[model samples]
Target: MSKTALITGASSGIGKELAIIHAQQGGNLVLVARRADKLNELKQTLESQHKVSVYVIAKDLTNANAPQEVYDEVQTQGITVDYLINNAGFGGRGKFHERSIEDDLAMINLNIVALTLLTKLFLPDFVKRNSGKILNTSSTASFMPGPLQAVYFATKTYVTFLSNAIAEELYDTNVTVTNLMPGATESEFAKTSGMEKQVYLNKQQRHIQ
Candidate 1:
């Protein structure tokens, strides 16, 4: 049987590319994103090209109930997940105190809370089967203290550290966890974080090649 991958934020950016890569490899997909249209479009494209099954969950990961909902949905469909990608995250610009409390909370909910919840919910199944792969998307910003984007950076640090620690704990198990640390590449992240000018100019000056 083909392996299955569940990717959060699969509608765009890194998540979207990852899904495409998995599809090309003939892996079945469970794509989750807030945009149903985009998710459906990707499903069509992948199924037509790869001839692999594609499932979509259109819901906001920031929701407290989302993790369980995703798990239950997968169970109802009799899908066995061989991989999980926690790639759903967003950043907020400006000082901690200056940013909107709601936006900061949403970032925390998605980046930290939601990620942890889903990991915990899935770890048992992966452990029981003694096999699985997990990929969590962390950022280079996780390595430093982001002044303007304080909470956002802190959340990513949590994700990276958490993933590493769990990976160590599961060292003896067949499961493998990898935290992808990607430097600023092209994405909607800048606009979403309201840091377009800052990220763009820095990229242009550094010519990150």
Candidate 2:
């Protein structure tokens, strides 16, 4: 049977790759991202190549109410998201104290706050029916403190712990939570996070969305 997956940050990077993988398996998709153009582009390619339905929701998840609005819109559209993949996040490389507070806050909003809200919004449906899955795009940075990217690491730590806790909570049910900590990739992340000029902290640099 073909399942319907709703993935955030589906415009690029791991999220986009995940969408492609799912489409290849004949699953329908509801892709959420700030870039409608990218989402539509992916939608067209996936629909043509895989013969699966693609729905695009363009909203900046950094906003406080975006998560709720997204949930409402999904409900209005009568889309049943069988899988929820929270994969949108960014990091800044610099001393925590030296970095701009606004930027750090935005990172928290996207990486931590937005992810949580989306999970909260969707997990209940999964629990109600004793099915569904959640895949959060955390990082290995969650495992320890990151000096240059302190805030980013902290947010990921929160995601890891949260996913674990929720997984345990749903042990009696069929609902499951999975956390992904990618090693490295070559993406627009380094350039956007202001890490391009810095010495590479880890070997096998990662691709970002």
lDDT of each: 0.93, 0.93
Residue 179 error for model 1, in Å? Answer: 0.4
Which number leads on TM-score?
A: 1
Tens digits of per-residue lDDT, candidate 1, 1-209, equal: 78999999999999999999999999999999899999999999999999999999999988999999999999999999999999989988887787889999999999999899989999899999999999999999899999998998999999999999999999999998889999886888888888888977887988865
Return the clash pairs for model 1, or none: none
Off by over 4 Å in 2: 199-209
Model 2: ten consecutive residues of lowest lDDT = 200-209
